[model samples]
Target: MEWIFLLLVGLAAGTLGSLVGLGGGIIVVPALIYLGSFIPGLDNLSPQVAVGTSLIVVIFTGLSSTLAYMKHKTVDYKSGLIFFIGSGPGSIIGAFINKSMNVQSFSLYFGLFMILVSIILMVRGKIKPLKLRSKYNYMRNYTNENGLETSYGFNPFVALPISFVVGLISGLFGVGGGSLMVPAMILLFMFPPHIAVATSMFMIFLSAVTSSVAHISLGNVHWLLTLVLVPGAWFGGAFGAKINTRLKGHTVITLLRVILIIIGLRLIYQGLT
Candidate 1:
């Protein structure tokens, strides 16, 4: 029964995460922590273990999503690589910080972060993309399925620092860091939504690798739990990416926002108790 629940959690996490470029860790971490309190074997779960296990699952989800998105030619590999330069190191730092947090504190902070991410999703569409004029910008054009080309660009100098912060949050919270990166890519970099999401998954894959290494070295991972979650997450990531190509996504986004808020409140209540 626990195994089945874990599998469902992984599937749900991966689908929602990949669909919105959030990297599924947001769902995995909290679910682990919640289940740990009641489930027999998981009763010993700590924040570190939960986070580490989630990051491992995130690696699979990100990779699966990236591959699926690559088939659509939406991933911006160059930008993803540049973002990794900063995120890789930042992930290490964040992993180290995660070691110091206790359950109550981690729950509180993660809950707050989830609420913030939900708010970001709510307003993301309303904000117009910013136009920045700079010689350092890396410009590119994306041709959609309908044969319309859209141009976008971003300055690496600006993007690197932001990605670093995103990585830090990712490692600390066991999230894929797409919640922050997607918005930044769309607003600051003028990336098309599909391109930003695809590129964000690529970066998430890289950052998760670094973060997972750090967690492993720290002895924070729950290997058994991670193994059980991977297959579901992997398939769900691919499924979500395929859906992204055909679905309007707005309805899903709305449902996701409500779920996040509910989860955030529940986590906050748990923390307070």
Candidate 2:
């Protein structure tokens, strides 16, 4: 039954994570917390362990999503690489910080923050667009694996800082940072929607790997739980990618906002109680 719980959590998290360029942590953490109440032996599951395990699960989901994006030639490898410049170290920092946090307070605050983030994302789309400012003087263009072309006029100064913050949040929360990264790429960098989502998946892969190592060293990971969750996450990611290709970008965004709202509220409730 615990295994079943893990599987269901993985499936739900993976599907939405892949679709929206989020790592499964956003879903996985809350799910695990909730699961602990009913599952034998899992009732003692700590938030740190849940987060560490979620990151491990994200690795599989990230890979599945990245592969699908690769086939579509939607992922911009250059962007992913650049984003990693900031994300890599930020993840490490997040892991270290997580060690010192008071779990209950962290959950409450993080939940509220997530809700705020979701609301911002929800409304940011409807607003008159803000100017895309790059600290760098010019935009760069690249072609993907299948010769699809896209351009980014970003100021690494600006972009990298945002990514670093995203990475920090990811590392702190074990969320893989996709939820924030995709939107930043689109809203801040003016990246094409498909490209942002694809690139974010690749970035998630990189960040998850780094974060996983950090968590492992910290003794936060639950390897057995990771094993149980991975298979379902992989399946969900693959299916979500397939769905991604079929649906419009706006559809993905719409779905993301709803999920974020639901998940965010749940987190808030969990925190308060």
The CA lDDT of each predicted structure is: 0.93, 0.80
TM-scores for the candidates: 0.98, 0.89
Model 2, span 95-158: residue lDDT tens = 8888886657767867876686677667655643246754563476767546777666667887
Candidate 1: misplaced stretches above 4 Å? none
Worst 10 residues of 1 by lDDT: 243-252
> Which residue pairs collide, candidate 1?
none
Give the C-alpha lDDT of model 2. Answer: 0.80
